[model samples]
Target: MNQQSTLSSSDMPGFQLKALLLLGLGHLVTDLSQGGLPVLLPFIRESFGLTYAAAGAVLMTSNLTSSIVQPVFGYFSDRWGSSWLMPVGILTASLGFSSLGYAPGFWALLLAVFVSGLGVASFHPEGFKAARFFTGKRRATGISIFAVGGNVGIALGPLLAVAGYGWMGLKGTLVFLVPGLLVGIMLIISLGWLSEPQRAALAGISDGSRQGPRPLGKRWLPLLLLILAVTVRSLIHMGIVAFVPFYFVDVLKAGAGTAAKMVTVFLMCGAAGTLIGAPIADRLGHKRFFVGSMVFLLPVLWAFLAAQGMAAFVLLGLAGAVLVSSFSVTIVMAQHVLPDRLGMASGLMVGFAIGTGGIAATVLGSVADVWGVLRVLQITAALPVLGLILALAIPYPYKEAGQSEA
Candidate 1:
């Protein structure tokens, strides 16, 4: 075997960097496809006259599919290589997303979402795994970069879709497909020259959880704890992201545009968290970064509720950054558990985290329906403190009983 082919991520060549950039771009477009859809759900329901539960089902399908399928993909991508599968998923997502512009009726619309859901769901295992492959030194930096790209995508989804709708109405929105196409082309063009990372990449460890780390043991304690903490994290994250605009409009008596800007401010803050928090985690250790993010957020969330005018928006932005960095920190932790299973670790972090959030959204939505959005957020604000405890309790793999194996 050629010795140069054995380069570790720390020694990854410039070609690898280019490849990773491509992966980041591809995953970004893919995520945009998924995250962008929910913003359009109300529009779909209103246009078609669907029930809330039915509309929720349409919105939820991609997440459920994404949550369930990534592990299978992760298990395989570890063995098979992540590069090829991602491109195929990108193409599928592009086609599926494109169909939404012309979807005929209830059945066809659901069909479009379901089809795109699979495509969107399929990308994560491979993308995350590949990011792990590309980054060295605990993979936090790589995961952070990859995560930020996805966050940008998720954060951008609604904004871009709404803009697309404004310019071309339904037809203009299809322009969103252009990003997917560019990414897919870049990936397909890049594949043949780049051989797979050695089996060593997949040889390090495994996690029992579909959402947990990929260390070599059955112990899933830390990962499970983090997942729960993250569920708490998401409940607050999504509630604010999804409902705040409406809250701004209906509850605060603001215009739709001002409400939209408020949501944008929150998401931009989250993007900053993704980009900045990774390096912070790298320097601070996962526990401090994860737990501290939760603690810091409690007050900001309170301020968010009490705030008025621009003050409320600013508080939302600040709280959002602190709260959501947990998403990035958890990604780094996933890599730690699945030393060998970068793709699986990534799938767990990317796919499962978001999927878990979907379930949380349902519960939060019901809470909002019953208790009202303000109270739902107010109750959610403090839940992350429990996340703080769980993150503090996270049993590191080296701390676990099967310690030496990883």
Candidate 2:
């Protein structure tokens, strides 16, 4: 590595709050479309008279397109700069999802969803990579802020969709078009400034002077284990989000309103956890915090499933926080392990791994059909054990000087 190419501590910029917040805003808008899709399923089903399986395929189409194609976009971003993708992606996603209400046929609906999914896929890799550069020394903290924006967007998506439907029937989805356009244009104007850190970081990576030696022994092994851990976490996350309302309404016999509120509370708590956990992880070590959160989650989730009333609510909130606290930690760890492939690492962590877990959660629908929602909840509760083991096995180089600082 050339001395000039190396980025010393002083050479690297400190946390750029404005840039991170802008990236976070982009994240929120991108995921809002994703979050809104599931809530619209029932209405779509009602309108089209489709079977449950067919309606599910709508979400599956979106998830598959958005998640699977992310790495390809990340590759492009790595090979060539991608600041423009952020604005283009936001507009495309907004346009596709907004048109959902007007699709004349089932296939048209899928096409719109697919387009929106592509937009979602395009935004994440570069968004995450830029978030990393903007945060500088506070990678975990900055990433958590960015991750929390997605969490809040997902939590709010259903609310916004429902409101739109209530106000103007299905066409209410058009309301999303406003934010997409506004934010997309804002990002475009900000591009020149935003690309500065990214150009520097890319230069460092390309020059082979970013950090210490890459991990040894099957370079992919560490990343594979990390992905497995993220997948398990996503499985539990998506499963709980998908099934918990049913569990509350059917088994616990809560009111529909209460059930809805529980989901919101759970998601909000997770967002809170993301903010609270990252700074601590920065000090305690990202891997250590990640593993500890997983270990703690198993018991908390089980108790939440078993308890009732106030106790159950407390446990549920705690479980959400503990489970989600590690979300940004895993992304940071992935980028650390694959420093040269930062964009791909971001895509795998935020896209493929999480999306795979969501797709796998659909299997729980089968479990709910054959056994019951309670059985599904039990299975969901047990998933963290696998995540814990994978976290333990990640082969994270805690002793490396570069890693230690990260």
Candidate 3:
């Protein structure tokens, strides 16, 4: 790569910085709408008098629906290449999320989340494929830039929910609709921006083919192992996000504001880790970076369990950073494994793997009911060990050809 190629400017081949920024912004709002739901869970529980199990059920419903549909969308994008999906996805997500305020009852709330989840599901496959093209040769850097939008949005969710719910109660969720609509309109207008570059410059990492289909028979073991690794990470992530506030408030006797702030701190630091780790992974090799991150997360989580107050907060932030660093790396690895199926790979890793984790959140909630949430944290701390084991099994790209390991 030359100086000009690394610049990420308008002149760089396949590097449309402006279009990427817009697509990233679109991703930001899409996830912002999704991320706010967990923040709203405690408030919703108190207002509706629901159990931890019920709350977990809500998350399960949303995650499962979103998980199940995303691969279908990815398959379509791979086969037909739809420009309308992105804008429509945003619109659908916005409307579904805005309905949370006046849902009236538990079933209605479930329906709202299901619809909102579908919207979330609709955006990722095509959105990620676009992000891939917008970066050209710098897929890692470009995907990181695009992924940071979701990272920031998810990080902001707790703070936004606290502020919105504090001021306007449940109805405050309607505020998300404004950004959703605005971004959707922008995506519609910028359709040409994504389409043009993809046609002109988009190419696969493993092979130089552009939008060409290829066989996947040789890649099954690696892809399955990759999905399992990603699933474990996502499971730990959603488990913490869904239950940590409850643990802080009920077990630690912390104030609601403090608990929300702690969650925000974790997510924000994770966003920082994504930005810092992506470029390094590009240079140092994805497998090493991912396995090392999971390795570091093990002790950090133990320290988080033992620490108190501000110390706990700091440890939590570190844990978030290490756990999240592999997110984009996993997605990019999936793409490398199935160069012709970028959309499917994106959906499988980003959507389905996350959905599987969301399903596990309910299981975690059930265990919490039996063993207590604090004990659950102790068990959860050991999860990274499993992730590290799987990370080690992720095959080197050149392993089959007897090339030197990365």
Candidate 4:
């Protein structure tokens, strides 16, 4: 294993800041496209006189397709080491999402959603690979920095939707295409710089000397537990996004604008948590920190459900910070488990797990229909117990790879 290639940021003070920032920008743009979709759903529903179930189907289709296909791309990326996917991912994501403004009917919108989902799926595995190339020792921190971009972009989606739809009508969606194109061009121009480390890694892999994936013998148990732990975390985070707005309006009697602001608080705080938690995870150990974060959530979620008004708001932000903080930690762990196939590890961590969360969203919504959103949230509060148990069992598989657990 070429341990020097994965050097710590402190060891190599001259890190690839330009490439990292550009990669972060691409993530921001792609997720911005994704984040905007929920905002557009209401407009589409109003224009088409569609039922809520039908409108939600648009999101479900996109999530389902993306979840299924991302690992395929990841597998290919590992084998081929393709640099084109990232730029192409941005371009296609833009095309699919931008077209939503002009879709004349239900099927047209569905088609657009599918294309946009594909773009999102294509970007992640390669994006994580690219981020790895730039970071040496501060892997969790670097991934967290990259992750904050997506969190910000997703948070910005609703704002863009409001501004675009309010100012220029549905056609305002086209504005998003401009940024995607510009970023894609920037990535293309920066390919030479980004490709250097990737070429070296590939060469190492070709010569059978690289660190990463190992044969899944007894190691499968830890990887499975980690995946399960992440699955629970994703479920809670996504559950908040899916249901919190309604909870605010229906239960707290907040106006639509206020509810929107609260959702923003949840997402933005999650981004902040990514930033704050990374350094802490670096020092405390990823497994211990992740387990502690999930265990801590039990009280946060209970308080959030039990409190009212300002107290609830504070708890919501706290919940967001604690739960979503594990996002990058889990991704880094996945790579450590299967170091050689970074692309595939990213696909499972980012793609497959999120899809599972989407299923949880669907099931939770159905449960909410019968049991009420408040009751359902109380049930969700208990999920972290499972994640905590899994975290305790997550073994350090990368000791052989010469990488320290973050």
The Cα local distance difference test for each model comes to 0.68, 0.80, 0.80, 0.76
Off by over 4 Å in 1: 1-17, 170-172, 193-218, 397-406
- For residues 137-222, write the lDDT of model 1, one tens digit per residue: 64566666766777777767777777877776654458777888888887788766443543343332222212223335554776
Q: 317-365, model 4: which lDDT tens digit per residue?
A: 8898898898888888888777667788888888887777766665775
Per-model root-mean-square deviation over C-alphas: 4.9, 3.4, 5.0, 3.4
Q: Decide which is better by TM-score, 1 or 2.
A: 2
Backbone clashes, each candidate: 7, 0, 0, 7
What is the Cα-based TM-score of model 1? Answer: 0.86
The candidate that achieves the highest TM-score relative to the unseen native structure: 3
Cα RMSD, model 4: 3.4
Residues 281-327, candidate 3: write the lDDT tens digits. Answer: 98889888999998899999999989998899999999998888878
Q: Comparing 3 and 4 by TM-score, which wins?
A: 3
Clashing pairs in 3: none
Stronger candidate by lDDT (1 vs 2): 2
Better of 1 and 3 by lDDT: 3
Total clashes in model 3, counting residue pairs 3 or more apart in sequence or in different chains: 0
